[model samples]
Target chain A: MTALLSLAIDITLLSVILAMLLCMIRLLLGPTAQDRVLALDTLWMCAMLLALALGLRFASIIYFEAAMLIALTGFVSTVALTKFLMRGEVIE
Target chain B: MTPELDTLPVWVSLPVTLLLLLGSAIVLIGALGLVKLPHFFQRIHGPAITITLGTGAILVASMIYFSALQSRLVIHEVLITAFIMLTAPVVAMLIMRTAVYRDLRARERGKTPPAVKDGEASEVYPFSTKKSLSAKK
Candidate 1:
């Protein structure tokens, strides 16, 4: 990677972290479940992006796999939470 | 432990840098909307930008960076993109439906909504605090 690209990745990482902090604020301050759920969804999206950005920064392939794992697990958890929100139960 | 990062020509690095910056900025804007928007219905639309455009841009950047750096096709980013594209809408839709249903039920309960302050609406969330509820009754 070039110097410019490295610097850009750093800035990108900063912005993603800032975004995560914003999501955390919403998650902690939620007065409703949906808001918190919405915040959590956005939070994981930021996490996945963080992983991808990290992969680029370090020139490693492992972070891509980590991003994939975050996406998969985040999706499952969000679905379960949404199901509970909809009907007060995930299994029923 | 950092991998040995060799040089990429300007042609490759420049666009990757732009895409990365663009993706992050968009993600930041989306998160801001989530926090700034007053209502849940309005706020829910915010992350759509992050999930789709922001993710797409970064993944494309990643694809280009990796391919150019390795001198071959490295396209695993595609799988993540596909999974996110397939799942984002479902999650958004289900969450929206739950919100609409919950709001309706709250309306039907015929009790005045708990007073909202600082843009927080008091809806019955599974994770809601109960001490306040007992006092309200």
Candidate 2:
């Protein structure tokens, strides 16, 4: 049972890492600022999920806290980036 | 490195494993779509898949795994799930609106022709007809 659980977590971790790599490619090659921002947002989300998978693997609460922090930061950064893209500045 | 998994029955472990795999696979597919799609608006649809169903699956897996392992309620994952659900669409909307705004401005300056065809323009942009006709004049 433990082996199965470990296998599942490992697979999830690997898949998310691959997803992040794909997002990175888009981030670098994206032709427009909006595409780049979209890639960044996806990258952060992958990071958050990666943190959660690690938490599951290690069976630790600390990773959960880290995941929450990532989520919060990801939202804020996405909002700020989009705002900048929209108005050419973040704040009025 | 072993933890409480040894004690879990097949019923519990099986579902958790399936959920994790399914969720990650969806996320990967979404990311792939984002990279492979031809346009920004089409690409926007990609991550929506991940944020809604992918995140939900993973969070539910985490919640079930922790709750089962600790023999107690572990619902904190819900917080992150809720936050993501509420915020992702807003971010997507902001980015999309910004893209449309930029494209429209470019059209007004005669930098590029209207992106959408006449038949599709009305559905996508209500003012597209007026803008395109005015720009042509």
Candidate 3:
């Protein structure tokens, strides 16, 4: 809410977005499937952090819930992808 | 003007700003490592820092900010911290295991794995080499 906190939040937001772009580069340029999956996992984390920074900037709690959702779904999807890689299918 | 400096005392904002900057800087560094590291194993290590330290700092900042502003505990961010702590290593382990297995399978089939060579189980490709790392011939 103070000026310094506000500026820090803005910086956090921009850096998070940059992190996501770096993840995208890995996602596209990854030499292997696991690399892509790893990139996606990091991407999800950046998004959640972005959401957190946004919530702080706006002084709202709703963004935290959205971050929680992203974290939950991202965990599931990454596990599923890894499973598929390991056994060629998500379920037997 | 709508009071540009609305009411977070320096006591709270100082720590929050420091933590926010720390979190974002670490996040950026981790992502940079992910992109810059040439090998899959090294790349896998990059986001470990992000998942752990970077996210932890940000969540702690959030907790402090919200709790201070609302004058209550407001600690639900801890749930996210716990979930990530429990799950991130598992995900990383699974991915690394899968990569190792795939490489072993390729070796068994007498084909060249992209990031390994010489049929030596321990011989993962080093990042300093200029050889192709693509999953192709």
Worst 10 residues of 1 chain B by lDDT: B111-120
Q: Output the lDDT of residue A32, model 1.
A: 83
Stretches off by above 4 angstroms in model 2 are B113-137
Give candidate 3's error at residue A30 in angstroms: 0.3
Q: Which candidate wins on DockQ? A: 3
lDDT of 3 by residue, B16-42 (tens): 999999999999999999999867887
Mind giving the per-residue lDDT tens digits that candidate 1 earns over B1-137? Answer: 24344457888888998999899899999999999887777788889999999999999999998998789999999999999999999999988888766755565566433223333554423334345435546
Quality class of the docking in candidate 1, CAPRI style: medium
C-alpha lDDT of all candidate models, in order? 0.86, 0.85, 0.87
- Model 2 C-alpha lDDT per residue in residues B3-67, reported as the tens digit of each score: 56788777778889999989999999999999997767778888898888888888999998888
Number of clashes in model 3?
A: 0
Leading candidate by lDDT: 3
Ranking by lDDT: 3, 1, 2
What's the CA error at residue B82 for candidate 2, in Å?
1.1
Model 3 lDDT vs. the true structure?
Answer: 0.87
DockQ (C-alpha based) per candidate is 0.65, 0.67, 0.71
Candidates 1 and 2 compared by TM-score, better number: 2
Question: Candidate 1 has which clashing residue pairs, if any?
Answer: none
lDDT string, candidate 2, A1-92, tens digits: 66877899999999999999999999999877888899999999999999999988888878999999999999999999989877889999
RMSD of each: 6.5, 3.5, 5.6
